[model samples]
Target: MMKLLRLCALLICMSNAWLLQAQTTDSISKIDSLRIKQIIQSGSTGKEDNNRNVLLNAANNTSPRDVNIGLPSSVGGITILENDLPVVYFFWPELPTTTWRQSVGLERTGLLKMNQVALTMGDLGFAVNSYSQTGTKEFKFKSRFTTSHYGWLQGDVNVSGPMSKNGWTYSVGAFLNYDPSTYTLGFARNAEEAKIFRAGITKYFDDDRGKITLNYKYTDSYNLVNYALFNYQTNGQVRELDNFRIGRDSYILSDGAVRFKDVRSGEYYMANLTGNEVTSSSHTINLFGNYKLENDWNFKFSTQFRSSKAARILLPPLSIFSTNAPAQSGNTYTIASTGERYEGNVGTQLAMNTPPTPLTTVQGRFSLEKKVDNHFLTFGLLEQFYRVNQFVSNRSFFYQTAEAQPRLLIGPNTDEYGFYGYNLGSEYHNGIENKLSIYANDEWKVNDRFNLNYGLIFRNHIVNGDYSQTPRTPDFTLQNATFTDINYSWYHIGGSANATYNLTRQFGLMADFQYTEQNRQLEGYSLPEPARTNKIRSPLGAFGIFYNNDFIQLISQATFLTRNDYLSRFNLVNPVNASEAVATTTYYDIQTIGWTTDFVLNPFKGFNLHYLITLQNPVYKNFNFEAFGVNYNYSDNNVLGVSKVLMEIDPSYEYKKWKVWASFRYFSDQFANLTNVLYFAPRWETFGGVSYKLNKNIDLNGRVINFLNQRGASGTVNGAELVTDASLYENRLLTGSYMMPFTVQFSVGINF
Candidate 1:
């Protein structure tokens, strides 16, 4: 009884404080409006003028504000003014009190509960939010834990405070979050536990004309499934591929031409229950600064560096055991024992040593902007460098001794190293990539009726790497592929122009054009081909008209695009000639045309509706390529995986303290390859959510993430034809795979 009384008293006090704050806001708003009018009449619009700055600040009530010093709260917190008194705040102070409704913003909706809000006062601000939820999986599989049941408990905290209040203003803040992650995707067998931490400091100098900020973040995550477990634990899928059974307790790749399974593990191969966990750690630092120079010029710069390491403790897949069967024909191989046609390795159960992987990146950007009369100009430079080092080892065995029919050797206690006949050895790779770019843009307003914006960019990329694959002991008939100094460099130039002309306040016309000449880098496949031209020249043009008013908006656009020298991959018997045998790259050209329309309606004060539709046609416009020992024409063919139609509708309503919304997305049938022999059915997905604010500090929400339960293949595999021995191999569309099934989640959050 005493605790209940205390809570009631606290609620009363808060309500009173909020009411006073609201009254104060109204009075201040009126005063500020009058002051703004006076300043405008006086023509005091200089950027360095204090009254102009105050007027600008007042105009952007929706703009993001820096967190309070020493406070971690991100919610609508107490905002202190240098002159005016701070107002008491809540989850949605912007909403009218009589409506008893939170703002329509997604952050205020309990159903989504995707963000945290905070309040701040003066140099001190703090915000906190936390939630716990349960989720069930679509697939029912048994492993370390049943795939059906999952749950997570997570919490976040943020704080900020003034570091110094001298001529140079300074502030510092910290944020932390903890998540016991669950298998919301239904692909991984294990739940992850993660801890994230970040800290930042900001300083203002040059009479508040410039500001600089430095931030650091660290993350530690554990209990992730390793490669082997990921392959064996998921249901009906192995290593992100659909598992197919060819015979009783036997299976061959159903999508591809490959025929074989790891017979050694028997049915339902049990992954190693121990030492199959993956752990990852990352550290990142960023430095950003912005300065306002003389003559209406502004400058901004930012640099970021990150390093990450992941350790995997699992064995590699075993090698396939194929006998020296009679070679029936080209692109065809037979396993002498099983009398089965084979295209790829099929075996399993190897005690391979695991290794740690390392990755690093450095990125930076600098920009300068100037405003002169009715024109805004900007110039920028960007750079990024990335590197990775990895080492992998796996060994498989095949025994065809006089006493035993060529059987794969594997087991929990099998001496794989001692009885290895074909020890598929280790590999090492060191890779690096660097990209740089420079660009300039200008936005010009010729008059009240017309506006134009244009920009051009120049970019360059350099990639170099070293890779080596050790040959299997006793030489397993596979040649060792190694490159000591693989290198590639490419450059590109791109430009774009956009223009808009206003016929009246409610109607306008817009046009856009873009062109580019680019050479794409063939990542990881550094072996150069003399006959391949990896260059592409693309141009796009669009014209559109739009109408906007107090209650409705509509926009329509028609676009035409073309690509020259588009890169395409092919398998050649020879790299130099199509008649020879080797894997190679090829080039082609493509074109596309599309039309899009979007409509938005605000029929009432608290209701909104949006509709969009798109129709497109894309086709290849050139040449031929060889794969699976056959040449095929692709001219005038539909571009692979391009859809012809797309549509979406979203509607929302808000009244009192209730907020509700629903959305739908649709896509037409799409082809899988240029041949147009394979296609996937159309897809439809639906989503909805409802939220209610129970009080100023608490909210409740429910969301239907995928209420329709639509099931269809999400993606296609294009290499099945390359692996087939027959001519005109059709691309494989994975069956039984699907987007997320029907799901509902509910959340309750307490804001402080």
Candidate 2:
């Protein structure tokens, strides 16, 4: 088609230009041959800037070229380029083609399509998106048409240039964006998602002898999620301790402690945690920037101003307690009492009049980073001002959720709210997060055959929220049992490092380690919870060799890793002396060690092969109040296997005429999982696709995703419906839940 011919023509021209550039590079360095280089490089040997810039440009190809002066697409066919091109950085680059840039801050881009490979400087870096994919839920059944997903579109381009004439190096950048809005429900339901458009301009100032910049961002994000989305909803999500898997039907939990399991390990872990609804709105304009002094040190300063609001809410009337459940014949009991113990046994849900919920949060962060010849370091301070309509509710609720039922750890009683009650409307949170981090990285180059990259990151966080026994409230006002009318803080520090050292032209070793220590901290409890130190250390590594010729290229890697998880709930009869009375009813920990391998093969320019393998040893430590359970601790270990393969083919003979890409995976993680109960993950999630150039101005694309049948009447004993799975899925008992039928979408892009 016409599109193919045009693409082929561009390729030919680019190929010729490439030859010219190559010949030129051998002749003389492009930018360095000029004046600027002699200064920045001072007296360096290698005058390489053309190819360097080209390669760097390719790595940063995220922008699209503009067509006209300042108007929308005016051509009926294809548009022309008039402005700068986007720079993109790909994980792997075998083919030089144009793909749309993802959202500003998100890993996924927008759904819009464009044919012209015009690259333009992207929006300012701090812009947000205002679109969501909240299907049947957002519009309700009547208005619902098709399911949609949303993302916060953020990204910026800062082009700083050095002017030796005026001894000034200036950076001019701008940010434009639209961010989505979302809301969460209290129980087992999902929240609604929306979006808002924001725009801002920022400019920096600096001189070659010094580095300084002053920047500001102004934005108004509308249609954000608020109290309305929370107070009323037909169905919501659930709250639990751990291990909840049901696929799509799984509550679309965001930040909840429990959630559905993906097709990864045999069971759920942190990677699978969801079920939190986030809804925020405000006008934020920050005049913030940084500067570097002549002493090789940097001093950064900034001040932010903002207006924010939240929806009104009622405090739920429920209390959590650790009491003996009805004794069954087979049930085990370590305690003599058959009676239940509670922190708040109030029988009634707060029977009070309702008023709209309102709260505000204003915060700021300041930091400094020092650049060492071989290291990069930074430290900072944070502060936030919060004003909430009700402090009593916010203070008491955190206390109960963190302590009330220190024994069962989790059960129906805990779900009802508190450890034993259901009303949670009473707890409100208005807090700020302040944190700092210092990090350093080094790229070691010994010779042409080997290279190594090492880094270390350290950080600390401080959070402050308001609490009061007699805070302003329309109803549900009671003496807060714990720290009412006082401010508390939680502090934690974590660090991580990754290293890669090449042994040969195509072979090397890589490793990473991260540690987080958050002990001696108090969480939200009916009373301040016990302070205990917990640490998580994870290390990952891989080694591989590659063989390559023009016709065929192959790579194989051996990957290994280890991870840890820990959780402990405390029980205290007293409201204040939390540290001493801590029963330490349950101390949970999970440790895992595993290995994985990946292989990628390219027989030709248009075709590629990809594969992966993973093996692991996972152990879990568990304890619960049930007498049948061990009062001490028990660790369960299991091994699991996972593998995958991907393929893509683009015919050179056809030029840009027709393109096809397909990926299939054979994955089985159950072998290493220890799940005899509860619904787990799927065995596989496959993908396939094809895009053809019907003509020069129009192209067609189609895809069949998640080919395997996972939504069958499978998995759990009772037949459960697939929640938000793929379009086409096979339902198998014990298998994961299926989404919908098959989903097929066709998009068209035209360039004149």
Candidate 3:
């Protein structure tokens, strides 16, 4: 921590090594607007040293950027942080968005819906949105600023002397990010705090045929604190539900005062136990590293290791509502989660709160890749192990104030309420994965008559996790000891192929096909085992043409995508999670297809046009996490974007000296989670700014985004929230991180 503080202190006294916008009348009057094709972006280096000439317009509009990844960096190339998504319906730097890596890579490593993506223009990259508030009240937005926005300060120092002559570079790099908007799930008053550090080294060896790359990275989002919010519709509306089991049956809580199982328990401790401990320090440290080989003929390897431990204060995976179980209407109830005393369901809704569990995941990764001539081949063999020493709560203060009911002491022995708190004391998980793929790609330059650019991909995947929940269980109980004994294996074979033949210089014919098959099975006697298989795909066939002006730089392609067998990571769960499998014995499948056309036209100077039209039908699948029943899926997504040179409105202003632009988009989901309801979210994202002469030695500039703020829906979803039909009240949330409102920023700086 002290090291980080010291590093931050030095930043105020230092200036970046490079500046992107060096435009000035004296600098260049002849080169006004840069062509679209000329812009370039280098991910591994500084600005000018790795520059491109993509002109950007200030005062830009809001629109969903294309998800395509094959386009050069000038188009779109932003990574999303799924854990923290923007509040608005559009893209926000802090909100959850999709990562661009999936659009191009053969594999995805993170959660599917959590990452936030950024769009880039030329050497500059930024995201815009309509709503920007992180909370569930009012709308607030942070301006879109390049350079300092998610940009990392990275470089390496190589000290190999003459050995560096062979390009044998051994390097080290570090970067830090401080964003108040990225903190606390917006539940707390303060923004989420994030800190990241990365270092790596490379060795060029074996005549350049083999280079060794090693890297270490760490990221921590901590010190997050938020108070409970009490803004029910009309304050004391008290929409309550009682989930009870009359007699011996178990019923989900919905209508208040419902009965539960035959409540039973052992005598509680009669002695007073007052315990308190304090130490000056507590922390969690995780160390991770990976080794990679530089090879071309299909050979690669990588390994990783990580270990972590947390402070003792976070102990106790407890929640308030979990403590109060029906006590036969008379017996003293010993609560495990919240110790708050309760007579009935009155005055109780006010105290209801979710569990506060903090996790410590220590994981490792191993991967390999290979390619052979016309056919590309890759394999990822991984063994990841997680060591969880203890489960802690981030809400210890809340628990401390509610000790009215006999509370549960963290330990081995406990009742039903206590057992829930003892979900997992300490355990380790060893997950193994094997993934293989092969593809053939090539572009046939068949005169000016016809052209073909396409390939095929085949993949096979299998995964197994070896671990257990709580190791200790009471005797005579059906036990689930070593999860290692329960095996889950899923196999998948997928491939994609496309061909585009140029019929004329202004038009072309193209078609593409994709297919995937997945099978899942579990191995265990006590554990239920189910085998299931599913095949999914997207059939895209389209024909179009375009003109290219290598000078003004204009190109366009109008093609259609017939999306078939659309699937989500969770939706594609072969056998689904264990508990779910035992309940349904069936899998979730999305077998519907949709068709959409995307057109990109960049004509004349300093202008570009992009639009998409999509239509889809409903399909049968489980909605949300609940296996209530299968239903048809319905929805539509439409997007459009246009960029123009601000200077075009006034020739007096040099194009390179000033800029402005705007984009807009709309998305409507009639039935969210396949439930019967209309959910619509519309967004207008825009960015506007210009460079002004603040004297010969200084310049003034600024930008704004999420100006016309509006969010679709936001609410609670922490397991129990489902009891009161929380999904029904989702649209009532006033603030959300999904849509950060619009805001503007201005800054003046010296040229030197």
Q: How high is each candidate's TM-score?
A: 0.59, 0.46, 0.48
Give the 10-residue window scoring lowest on summed lDDT in candidate 1: 31-40
lDDT of each: 0.42, 0.28, 0.26
Give, for candidate 3, the lowest lDDT window spanning 10 residues: 114-123
Q: Tens digit of lDDT per residue, candidate 3, span 362-415?
A: 222223334344333333332222222212111111121221112232212324
Model 2 stretches with alpha carbons more than 4 Å out: 1-192, 202-421, 424-431, 463-480, 484-501, 516-565, 568-587, 622-634, 637-658, 665-675, 678-682, 692-701, 712-741, 748-752
TM-score of candidate 1 relative to the true fold: 0.59
Please identify which of the two predictions, 1 or 2, would achieve the higher lDDT against the true structure: 1
**Per-residue lDDT for 40-96 in model 2, tens only?**
111111211221111111001122222111011111111211001111111011001
- The root-mean-square deviation over C-alpha atoms between each candidate and the true structure, in angstroms, is 18.5, 19.8, 17.0
Q: What is the lDDT of residue 630 in candidate 1?
A: 72
The reply for model 3, stretches above 4 Å from the true place, is 1-163, 182-190, 203-212, 222-430, 458-460, 466-491, 519-586, 621-654, 685-703, 711-737, 743-752
Report the poorest 10 consecutive residues by lDDT, candidate 2.
Answer: 31-40
Sorted on lDDT, highest at the top, how do the candidates line up? 1, 2, 3
Better of 1 and 2 by TM-score: 1
